[model samples]
Target: MPNMLLGAFPIGTKSGANNSTSNNKNGKCKFLLLCGGYILFLILGAAMFSAIEAPKIDAISKRVQSFRKQFLQSNACLNDEDLEEFLKAVITANDRGISPLRNATNEMNWSFGQAFFFSSTVITTIGYGRVTPLSQTGKIFCIIYAAIGIPLTLVLLSAMVERLLVPARWLLGTFNSKLGHLYQPFNIRLLHLSAIVFIVITLFFAIPTAVFAYIEPTWGALDAFYYCFISLTTIGLGDYIPGDGVSVDNRSMYKIFISGYLICGLIAMMFMLTIFYDIPQLNLGQLFTESTNGETEKLHLSSNNTTCYSGPSGLYMPQRDEDTRRAIVRIRPHGDDSPSPDEAPSSLNSGIRVP
Candidate 1:
């Protein structure tokens, strides 16, 4: 009997090994295909963007050259070469946030407030490109500073988002109580997220847009709004920056306030994204990575007792939820469509709940 069992075990083990190897091959193939598709997507985006904008760039360059010629012709005192050299000097200085124009009222780039603002933009990854390190030493320092600071900033934001999630979850609860019966859980969750998004826009984007437009002499309403949107998205297009407009009193203080605004606005934007990702239906990641047993990719966040936005598998929440106030919905058992009343609908079904 022992010999027969051993013989059977060998065959079974070999079959299981074959299955494991086959699964691994499939996973690798899927990963490679996904990567190839991503690269193609990037190429497609680049082509489209260039097609739309390359002509505009060419036209701008031609216009700039024409202007340079006009300027050289008008000013007889400065020859072409001399004017070119002077303009190059001014342009170089301008790129480093230094104003070479005699009448320019812009603050010095390395002044205490302006330097602090630049540092803020660096760590926040909102590299506006309006000011930049030119020296080799400064550039190297920037590389190291960003490498260390970006992750630290993300960690800080994660902790802030975790605590901020508490109130957001409570807001979900309020919605659930008010409209849990009238609509499906998913709809209520959508409305809840929408409400929070509206509030966030009002607080971080809309109000700030109004103030920036009011204070920034050269910026119209649209420009101020565009700046707010770009800054919050961290695109930092650099076309417009706060306190960089025409003469303004206390411009240094204005830059400092703008730096603080970026910090708070980013935190609020992250909180909004957290809420959006909390909805499992919106997790496009599940489509790519769900497994046969219904599990998918998972991440564990142990530090600060905080959790990231778990894509599709489960709550980033720990096995035992330590915080009662956090409204996390857990996945129900596979093949068990009917849940007991005590179980209530897990986060999977409702996308939100107390237990």
Candidate 2:
């Protein structure tokens, strides 16, 4: 009788297990259906948005093409008299402070250096208006080229700034040590940064601004300041340009000077950013977001614990997360195969697996 009861227990447990499995399967199906519905809704919304925006984009494109056609029409290649008239119109526009609608062109075969400078100016958003890309192919290429070139310029600027900060970091430490007793670390660092800013402004900003204001036939202090602000911000509106201020014999020298100004001003800005980072409060911009906060904590841990922290005094390293490491291991099975570099060993598993 006892053996029969034991057999009945197995049947009872099997029934319970099957019921639980059916319940779980139903739950999963419901969840999957809900997820699929949400995704479909999102896709529909995006399609609607694109459909609405399409006409506006098409209209703008059509207008641009129409203007391009007018500009590139063979009549645009004017004789000397016509050219003179055109230039005078441009100059007159400058004098009267009236900007005519710009048209496209269909002329290529510019000097390599000219093309390079033009590309740089456009990518930097400076649009100096000294030279512009001509030709339908050139304009199309210009759009694509600027897309890539601007990002490249940003990366180059970032790298240059990183390199420049080496000295700035040392200077910060020196100042901190000197003023440790008298001021907080943040205050001392700010003082050090101010000194650097004073030097940079004296040479790069104030001096250049004054000189440009005095020489530029039409530029006042406000115009000069605006130019400085615009250029430094990389707005490159091509409206208020530097060379337009003066009629110099040596255009090459003027361009070289402007290039130097750009480089120095960028370096100064990076120095200011270094000081900004020294303040723990403002520096939190990188770590303030929910996603980045996790990244920040990981960085803090790694920097505090590892040799990466000791490389330089002011080099900021982030903390690492064991939770993320474990999550990766859970997703990938580690039964027989070696784990990937990113995957951590689970506590339940004994062997140290390598990928």
Best by TM-score: 1
Please estimate how well model 2 matches the true structure, expressed as its whole-model Cα lDDT. 0.61
Question: What is the C-alpha local distance difference test score of candidate 1?
Answer: 0.77
> Which digits, one per residue and each the tens of the lDDT, describe model 1 over residues 188-224?
9999889989999999889999998998889989998
| 63-86: candidate 2 lDDT, tens digit per residue | 977865675575667555675588
lDDT of 2 at 306: 30
| Residue 145, candidate 1: C-alpha displacement in angstroms | 3.7
- Tell me the spans in candidate 2 whose CA falls farther than 4 Å from its real position: 1-117, 128-131, 284-292, 295-355
Model 2: lDDT of residue 56: 99
The parts of candidate 1 lying over 4 Å away from their true place are: 1-37, 75-77, 134-144, 292-355
Q: Give each model a TM-score.
A: 0.72, 0.51
The true-structure Cα RMSD of candidate 1 reads: 12.1
Candidate 1: give the clashing pairs: 329-347, 330-347
Q: How close is candidate 1 to the true structure, as a TM-score?
A: 0.72
